[model samples]
Target: MHIEIFITTNYYIGCFFIYFFMLYYCYYFYNMNRKSKRILVYGIVLLCVFGMVVVYKKNSTLPLVILNAVRFYFAGNPTEDVGYAPVSSKDFTVSVLASGLTAPTRIALTPDGEYMIVTQLTGEVFVFSRKNGVWNNKSRLAGKIDTSVLGFPPEELGLVGAVFSSDYADTGNIFFLYTYKNSEGEIENRVSVVSLKERFGTLVFSADPEVIFTANVPGNFSHQITDGIGVSIEGKSHLLFLIGEGFDAKRAQDLTLEGGKVMVIQADGSNPLGVRPYPSFPKLQAVGIRNAYTLAQNQYDARKRVLIGDTGPDIHDRIIYAPFF
Candidate 1:
């Protein structure tokens, strides 16, 4: 059933109401004096109602593009015929480094580059070492650490990433990011620090994990928190990572919130010392990101550039690199 109401500049407004205001809006547009006004009303009403409906329904999804009024004036995302740049096989060769692992989500190499720590989506952590041009199993660093596997949309949750401290050989500190169900049964992401020790040629955890950072978002995962790494910006070691908007795209612009932002913190999760932080936010390096997937950093003497993989508001998944300093 539908109810319709008609109104104009001088016409009497109807008192009719419905579960959605679209019913009256459509009716009002039909009685518009100009075709241009009717078209404008129709376009806006349809876009908003359709988008909201998609978000509320289970299994329903929005358009691939992020809906943003600001991006409309800018050039569209760059695309190519084959989707990615092609490299010559003579210059580079791809090979499997390791196998027999289940869903390895994040990996970190020690500062000495002797051992690599790998974390799986199933919450298992393993280590591997290279010998004679071949990768060999080192040991299982951890297993069944417990992760929230509810992040199906884009699968951006779980044991997402890990980073080794600059002095990993001496400090043995490894930072891991993973998702878990909080006491309220809501999925939350946390960064935990663990010390790894080698005893009798086997790697093992040295102590109880120390929780460093915790982020709370909606249970449904679209853009959860992502990877972090240790970087020296101007010779100061700091922890840098990225986060997604987690369905609240507007919050990406909010510096007070961690969503859709780049955060720079200490290895122990304190506000980074020595270097000046990003603008007013002590922990936040940058904001206004969509789905922060992966972060890669390159440094030369103190100049550091961070490459960020972000899935967009629309179909434009992008890899953007910039220096926060």
Candidate 2:
């Protein structure tokens, strides 16, 4: 709860527009006309009396920091300006708990929230079960190490990233950041941690997998390691990942090279909580990044912030706000 971390990059990402600038000013007063709907109904009656004085001052982190800024919105900017509003809020409701399931990507929950640890791009790892609230039973974490995404650039690389192990529901263990081949075979990039269970109902991997770090790059297949998201702060669990400069991108502005940045460690399997200076990354927290494809953490704020959606090389896609001290 003593989270303070800071570092910025706001070409108008001005710290994530202070949480969607009031939902893009309520999406410009929902296409105003009737005197801007009475000034958007007096700004929703002064935001329902300023959210009942911020929920009677309990301020549960300002409504989970606007629901983690609408679950860290991911679409829109198909060249903004044609009524740029990518946040709709009917008090939120977006469904589809399960589907054809393949090439999934990322989603981890279990910090005792029942379960929901999906990840795929041809490396698989599913596990639903939200008790009765919809998420269903879709198990699937079968074993196999030395696994590589193998999905090849079809929408970009495989096994992008995965996390879980801040006591993964009593230590089912998890963590991986694809693309292997080490021991001098070249194809670098790995981040193990394995160990899982639940046999009969499906969910294997109770052995090999503890290589927690690696990097050699030149694998050149797309920014490779994209997420790890597991932060603890006071309890000390840390694992915030991202590394995709494999295509060289000027060696991610060279900080003794580890490509891109945001790579921390010690996610409950201790070691290396050191060195970080230059463009930093010997456990660095932030640095000239790109391809920040996925990372959105708020942890009920106290500024535990970790939102980094930075992707640029054309059309500046900023939103880098790492916080933790």
- Give the per-residue lDDT of model 1 (tens digit) for 11-67: 122112222456656667666679767676676666565545444342232333233
- Per-residue alpha-carbon lDDT of model 2 for 135-192, expressed as tens digits? 5746655644455535532324556677775666666778877766446545566778
Poorest lDDT segment (10 consecutive residues) of candidate 1 = 7-16
Task: Give the winner by lDDT.
Answer: 1
Task: Quantify all predictions' global Cα lDDT against the true fold.
Answer: 0.66, 0.63
